[model samples]
Target chain A: MTTSSYVYYPGCALQHRSHAYEVSNQAVAKALGIELVELDDWNCCGATEYFSVKRLPAYALVARNLALAAQAGTEELVVPCSACFLNLHKTDSHMRQHPRLEQAVNEALEAGDLHYKPGSVRVRHLVEVIINDIGFERLGQLVRRPLYGLKLAAYYGCLIVRPDNVLDDVEQPMLLDRMIEALGAEAAPFSMKTACCGGHMTQISETTALEMIHRLVTNASVSEADAMVTICPMCQLNLDVYQDAANRMFETSYTMPVLFFTQVIGLALGLSLEALGFGQEFVSVEPLIEKIRDVPPARSKPERRPKQALPMPAMPQ
Target chain B: MNATRPPTFFDRVVAATPDGERLSQCLQCGTCGGSCPSAADMDYTPRELFAMTMAGLEEEVLASNTPWFCVSCYACTVRCPQEIPITDLMYTFKQMAIEAKRFEHRSTADWSESFVGFVEQRGRSFELGLATRYHLFHHPAQVFKMGALGLNMLRHNRLALRPKSIRGIEQLRAILDRAKVLAEKEAWR
Candidate 1:
């Protein structure tokens, strides 16, 4: 379940916004005996918009990270943030397919006195690496305090399992499901699991993003999930930062705490809340932690399927 | 400016895109439109936008918020039966809008500009810097509104008040510049 080496790229979000994901990721990795070396001189992956506005600059920006990871002399680079993972992985795939893009990206890199080859370094998300390299069997072995009473909705957001995927099915991935099960927490039915979290749309148009977040938060709550576990910072940010805004917009109050997948892993390993970087969210985890601590471990109560259940409600216009 | 010029919107988009010809293959089915979370907000659903582009309604398409309304979620791109990279196609429309200077989605456009500028200048994003720039150009009043949220992030160490830049920033700037020049010469425009 342990590997000798893999490089890590925390991306822009982890440096600040999702610092907890970074901390908990490293803690979980260290406990699992895999040391993740940070990539040197990495730059932002252009996040969501740059690539759309200016094609060449975005590719060049992402390529810089790839070139550095390759320079670090590792075949596999593990990314904790899904946006970073997608940027790195998608760039490598594009470079391999389109000679023009490859030439342009590489030419841009030459200015930095750096160059990258297509497919030289493999990019894997931390969750995928955990589920694959460090098998769930060993991951389960590390759990000191099993999350017996917690229920989680594995939120994949838009980037992680998307246009280019290898770890799991694009629409209905089970990697996180298995992980939650291993830690003894129930993987609640996440019907809207693969839906978009509005990404940076919340920054530009809160009205539209609020609608999207409201759907996701409401769905998770209806499923009786305790927390929504996510693999991307953008998803966590939108869900947490805009929870109250969403509730206000929809005239519905829903409290659902979003946690990075690694945070859940850290909790299962019995690491301190401080070590996992908990209590740093807009929608506080304080109540959820208390509930988990005060309650005895209980089996997940599955929602009973109703016979001839009323038809699904139509989407609001 | 060039009323006498040839009708070239489709040809230009095709030449610029990796699979521009695929745009012609759209089944007129509303899968992209249906799957889009922001479709209700868009002036034209991606389906309608694609149709407009094919119809050579360049001015309307360029000025419309259809492209900017896209959050780049890729639900359409993933679910498209024709395997169209609809999101990237939307991105193409966004770039065209920016280049044409006919875009009306001021707030989104400002954010995109600020985001790209932040990446270019610091070799990484300064979250506060990006937000401040966006607010200045788009909605200065919202800056005060965001104070409480900003304080929460600041308290949690989610944002650093002073940006810590990455090493080799000059090289990053050079790469972006050179790539711009090279892309300009790609024979698409």
Candidate 2:
């Protein structure tokens, strides 16, 4: 945890479908002086679908990555994709909890001449690394081009902070919001922040997925956020790629721009658009970029509470 | 003379789940169902499904579309008062339904198989291959509908046309094969 360097595990989706996230993450990391060493010869972590079909094999698949990371001798393994992060984290945690499963997985690993001790290497999400390792004070000082007038809705699709609230609150995560604010952008009140974007249901059950996507876009639209920022590639893909399909299915004219948190951070860091991989988004961010003001707008006045209204319960510490 | 009932479906599920002893502690609360984003799409709510499982309604439970609709967001799993690992149980039900050939939805299973097929062959997932193979086999009409999106991805250089194999794919294959054997042995046990 002391080292600013980590073994980077860019899951398959980030390598193929979400290059914007990869480049921006790297650019941001470099600017922050954090060293990211890519894990060599890594394979798929089976995502969510693999575990459903075969449980033991899925653990072994993710364990292979852990083994490789351990072999690389890095204390921390930074994974960008939410699904990959969850799979790797869950595998390690479960291996520690269930000795039988660990024994079974290690038996499989014997074939590859690799073995991993549970908890040998820590699995972390990239956002957590950037936020925790390099605090907001450092990020605020480093911001060259503040995203002043932009209103961003932080979308933390399920996997990153669930099944074990590894990073933030399960129902209401604010790390993304805090990051948005740290970048000098307004964090919109998006209630459906933790809502599911239907994962691969777009392929399996199109009707249901479209409806789910429609709801998410509709929430951001109602909130009047300029764009929705996300950490998971699947969330971005669902909201960005299938936006048109959702629009057609719902007959709504919502044009919310979905972006990766890294891309937004890169913008605030004053990096060139090309360096941040901006042009690759299905929804063009050019118009959103135009809305960036040189300085943040004046803070809006807080609404006065009603005399009869009861005090809201304090959030758990 | 003595009479005894067979092991319930609940018993089978609990036995299969790694930490499934907690399943018996389910409060019958609808939190899982209420928290589920796709609960409306499920034939039976998670609470109802749990009751049905304990009642030994194996065929009906397997045939239900409840498990297929789960997106694995894990909202229900975290919120479950009983901490029943509700999401993992969904995976179990999906596997069981697929093995029994009792699942109502074919396209979901097909998509999963196609995804795993790519992973197995190349040690990585090929989104382009998964999309083409799945849409072509299941919804040929939707291919034309999704053509522009596919072209858009290619235009942005986001979609890789070719699948890349890892150098240690042979090692990966050996590990996966051994894992498969272990899974089968566990199932038989």
Candidate 3:
């Protein structure tokens, strides 16, 4: 059964680097009659780097958040960041899958006088809860202002739908597409919808990371999307902030606005731009905001050449 | 002719990873290699890396940049017909490489260390600190290049100048300390 209330785990990046996501997410949640209780004293989920550094310690670190969420008395723990969601969900399942790991992690948890069962608190991404719990039907009804004439490409970064195809189809997820359509926007056909955003590769390998980012933006441009709506901070940061770097490296001119899905949802809910953390983005979404219409575009047939008219002859050289 | 020989590098990797025995089931299929977005940048495709590991090429495997170039997108793991957990094995390989001090790129190691350092210090990661320290240590020239981006983040209020410590920091530290001991007991290093 889906619940209206959930324990929120705003991972470190969300609290600082992705504060806009947190603000817009909270506003959208409140408007939808969903209560998100912040898990008390929540620490880092160790991200991806920690696991590569220390495996057992990293599991224990992520399990700490799970232990806290379990103690918070909420049956579901909703996370905003894709990396955080993956770490929390992966650790929980790993503990259940491996007894030795479960015992070791539990022993570490004993230091804080906390213990967590693998399935005590269900780990979910914020997008998952919004799509599954409040649902598109209610979301459509709650749209105070439909975002018409706005072409949006739903970009789902790597971690959200991988390792386990729990949330959506691994190859071609439709939840993001459906949600965008529910917002009264055209969901452009994006081929690189589930491509990697290079994560920390930007810091690790500049050339390789920029090439990946270039592919994403170039694809979105080909689709003629007004903006690319993303569900993860790292994706947004890479596509928005590092876009200039990619342009410089590739010598291509591409202006694609990357935004958090919550911000887009907030706009549909009639929330103000400032309230939705609009200005926090590196790429200006102002032009795109002006494109939203009050009503959907009229359905009219495309103009065709006159039946009697002959095709234009090629100009003489 | 000996029936009992020491565990090969492949055996060590399989043993280190949870449910990693599936590594033996790898069909040398190119699904993982084809699915990887950064495979072009990798010195060896994941399939070739696996075969090399089975041949006990520890030095070449550890020093290769394939694992570090991985974005951890798990495109390979979810699609692996053998369910070999290719991504998890990547993580294991990264850890082993770190232990061997065979980092093909020093910046990758420094980046992870700084990230883990901040997490240990304040119970949460400080992005600004992590970035500043990493850039200053590894690529000082790139620091100036990233100056505008950093300032832009600051202007937008996305970058926090100060790190915030969680209320249960002491408890968190104790937990990490215990976990470290347990990790050592596992003999990972």
- Candidate 2 chain A minimal-lDDT segment of 10 residues: A1-10
The window of 10 residues in a row where model 3 chain B has the poorest summed lDDT is: B180-189
Question: How do the residues A112-214 of candidate 3 rate in per-residue lDDT, one tens digit apiece?
Answer: 9999999888889999999998899999999988999998999998899987777999889999999999999989889999999999888878899999999
Candidates 1 and 2: which is better by lDDT? 2
- Sort all candidates by DockQ, best to worst: 3, 2, 1
- In the range A1-317, model 1's lDDT, one tens digit per residue, is 44566788888888888888888888878888888888887888898778768877788889988888788788888888877887788889978988988988898899989899999998889888889887989888888888877888988888788887667787898889889989878889889988999888877887899999999999999988999999988899999988998998889988899999999988888999998988678787877776564334666466777888778999999
Clashing pairs in 2: none
Model 2 agreement with the true structure over B84-135: per-residue lDDT tens digits: 9998888888778878876477788877777888999999999998999888
TM-score of each candidate's B chain against the true B chain: 0.91, 0.93, 0.94
* Comparison by TM-score, 1 against 3, better one: 3
Runs in model 2 deviating more than 4 A are A1-3, A306-317, B1-7
The TM-score leader among the candidates is 2
Q: How does model 2 score by TM-score? A: 0.95
lDDT of each: 0.84, 0.89, 0.89
